[model samples]
Target: MTIMSSTSLSSGLDSVTNKSYLLHFLQLLSTCMAFFLVTRESTWSVDISNWSMFVWCFCFAVTLLTLIAELCGLQDKLHFSWDRFLITSACYCALFCLSAAIIYPIIHLQIFPDGSPRHHVIAATAFSCIASVAYAVEVVWTCARTGEPSCSLLGLLKRLEIFVACVIFAFLSNTYPSERQPALVWCVAVYCICFILGAVAMLRHRCDCDESLPYSCLGFGQSVLAVLLYTTALVLWPLYQFNGDFGGQPQRSNELSCIDELTSYLCVWDQRLVVAILTAVNLLIYVADLVILTVVSDRGSTQGLRIPSSY
Candidate 1:
């Protein structure tokens, strides 16, 4: 074909691809909105708050990322990626815990002084563990449902275990006697968990899975954007909720503190920004995948991919 013909064809293809991407994005957004509304326990439901949106968005992001990756031939199979889900879950768990550490301490320094208890710290850790385990169960279930290696392998499950363990350690770093060193230890734990698990999620590894993201779907650009969205939702939005250590009181309480010390961090104000942050990040990832698929329509273009797909 002539150069002009080739350019026109490329432009046409790009336009069609963009339209399809937008359509797919709309569809996913609509579905996740419904899911979020229903899954939102009534007590936790609020208009546009942190706890309300953080994890809600995160899970949606992970699933959405999987779908986009599939479209770009990024996955061995198109179903939800358990490994991706677990890493994201752990990262969000860390974020939720950190939000708790900051918002909680400031919210009740007068009442708790020493800063709640080791229970809150531990409970947050347990939350990450449970979330990781839950996702592993999901991975196993997906494999069972599909009868494929994607779900059957223990490598991904074990990798998830590694993330969960890291999260637990990070959280426990603060669960020591409260008075000795509370805020600093807890905050450090949160950062540690976020960096370690978030890095793993953004990259990825298990069995034969390639750790780096697809050139089209993820990069420093997308990762930074995800973090920005998360920080905006999870940590920043809650500043308004504060008013001198008393305004935002816990509306809920952890009944399961006995089940595990970490599980006990539950309180009314435990609403975290994780759901929102995750949602935003996942949404971005999916968009990135679409862009990649559109821009690099053939194997030839992917020669630029120094790293393989993380789907």
Candidate 2:
């Protein structure tokens, strides 16, 4: 048997803890910066801006709470109970779907116009696609790890809600710009109601569990649907552009005007740069999660090892 000195063990733990904290801090910083840039530079409609703000804010809150929990050594307390985790994850999954819907048109229309030499439009589009995949993976991972039926059920409901929202948005995009706002607002309101209903149901049936197999299948279905919808939107985006059906007219001139006046701050930035940074940060977080999961699984397996009684 090999032994580690107490000091060496403690030092190793400290190194791991510090690395975790650094990653969290970087996530918080990148998210905040991206939010700031989007708020200032996004030339999309007010509805899209509002939705983007909501996503950035949600990310900010999660990261902040996680950082505080880590520093305070209160991670266990901060862990979402299985039910809460399902509900929260469902909500985020829905939000990501909505994001993909909104971003698709924006990228195709060049709403934020990639003036940067780095081809920000392609980067932004790539990030949006990757982010959607990340969200889907998160939903499925949560369900699989918890073996919770409600998790998959709630995810299904949210995915359907997002699918309907995207369809409506696609239809509206073909309509006159002046007429789309009210319809979009109403659609958002209805989805919000549905989301709330799902949450309440989750709360009411916290202890409920059906066989995991059906829900696992449903979870897989939901993920596939999400990827399909997002990719479909991406493919349809260029068609919308070519047909001149992306809103009433291009707002590129107005966006350029806004950028010119922001010589002090946002002028130097473009959506792609912000998006690339956010994507990197999200990838880091995903990698960190995988590492943590591996460590936990290894420790559990080690603890389970036992000599045969016959020996």
Candidate 3:
């Protein structure tokens, strides 16, 4: 009976190990394919900004490194370390950015000249949809495994926000192509505000510190960077627009006018107006994240210093 039991246990362990290896292999393969697609797309146009291409390449590289680390079983060694958290966060951000990039161009295809190829738009839309779904599923699985209240809730909310944004963009693209830009701009502003509010709530009632979990400092820094970038973009857009730098004939005048004088005046500068609103929201979000990081860090340090009583 002992021999039989031992044999069965050994067989079970082997089976589990084999399955793990297979899963890792598949992940590695998928990462490689994603990397290839992004790289190939980057090389297609010389007119494209180098910085944008570099960002995409960097994201894919980070993702590939993460997959390699997992396949080599190094994740077990560095699982709770900052290195692991950084890599995982980078992969998530990269994937999000890549998916956004794909979807953005497709949804705003009308913004481009008619001479541009249409095939790429269709391809990008398909890929972005597939990738977004996959990412959403991964988030659900992670939430299930971790069950960290604050983090899991945040992840779920972020996924929902992204999905909703995609849906709204799609609808705007199909139904109100002429108004899509302003609509999207407003959507972004609202999203930033909502995100800030959610972050505040989460930080106020964060779950207990988990050593293996990623630090909030990373998010704080990202928020700051986002604020800066959006502010700069907002400032530059007006300058470029007023300077007539976006060459091609000026926008045709609209005979339709609002009944209210203030509304009509605001409509004339819609682009700048939306950007300014977005920038303000981003700034608020940045401040909220900064506070969250400071509070969490202080709490973590205090917990570390507490001494347990002996019975």
TM-score versus the correct structure, for each prediction: 0.29, 0.42, 0.44
Overall local distance difference test of candidate 3: 0.42
lDDT of each: 0.39, 0.42, 0.42
lDDT of 3 by residue, 1-311 (tens): 99999999999868755643453344434444443454554423321222233434454465466657755878677635433243234335435545455534533353333543434444444454454344334334433433433232223333333333333322222122134345334444554554554344334433222231225555556545545654554554444433355421134243132233423432334423344454454445445544544555666633332222210
Q: Which tens-of-lDDT digit does each residue in 16-55 have in candidate 2?
A: 6675566445545644554554444443343333444455
Model 3 misplacement above 4 A: 1-56, 79-91, 98-103, 106-108, 111-116, 149-277, 284-311
Candidate with more favorable, higher TM-score: 1 or 3: 3
Model 2 residue 139 distance off true place after TM-score fit, in angstroms:
4.5
Q: Which 10-residue window in model 2 sums to the lowest lDDT?
A: 302-311
Residue pairs with colliding backbones in model 2 are none
Tens-place lDDT per residue, model 1, 1-311, is 69999999999868755643553354345335533433442222222223323443554565477557646766555355544443444334334334333433232232222333433433333443344344434444333433333221222322333333333332332222234434323433443544455455534533322223323244435445434543443442233222225233223342223234333343223323232233344434434543544444444244443222222
**What value does the lDDT take at residue 274 in candidate 2?**
33
CA lDDT of 125 in candidate 1? 32
Scanning candidate 1 in windows of ten residues, the lowest lDDT window is 41-50
